[model samples]
Target: MAERKAALNRAPARPELKERLERAKTIVLTEEQMQEQRASFAYGNAPRNSRITKASATSATKRIRLSDPQPVT
Candidate 1:
């Protein structure tokens, strides 16, 4: 009995698109204004960082002092 080789039906690879997708996973922004947003996604989709941590957000959250009535001297 003769053994026949299986044919590989491979498609042409698009390296450029692959590179673009890889780059999208780690979008870098140099502007300070967008630091927070960048940090939020720095880990690619995982919710694990200062920006994603619940304690960091709630503990560091600022409360409005205006909520209290001003003391009239």
Candidate 2:
């Protein structure tokens, strides 16, 4: 109980994820930017047989699609 109380008292000065997101939440899309991003995400550029359902995680190691930024397939 004493350790738990100390941990709570020394808890973060602010919510950590919220603090990180505050700096990183600047991805608002202009219409042109939205169109460009959508256009870039498909066709032969994407990985073949590349998808991640919940089951894929359990079977074995998975391939990382480093070729695609924010890899979509």
**What's every prediction's RMSD, in angstroms?**
17.0, 13.3
lDDT of 2 by residue, 1-73 (tens): 8768776765566788887777656545454444444445443254667674334432222232223233222
Minimum summed lDDT over a 10-residue window in model 1 is located at 57-66
Q: Residue 60, candidate 2: how far off, in angstroms?
A: 36
Which parts of model 2 are misplaced by more than 4 Å?
Answer: 1-22, 44-73
Query: Poorest 10 consecutive residues of model 2 by lDDT?
Result: 58-67
- Cα deviation at 9, candidate 1, in Å, is 2.0
Question: What's the TM-score of every candidate structure?
Answer: 0.24, 0.28
Residue-level lDDT of model 1, residues 1-73, one tens digit each, is: 1343334446679999999888766754334424444444443454644365533433333331233333333
Clashing pairs in 1: none
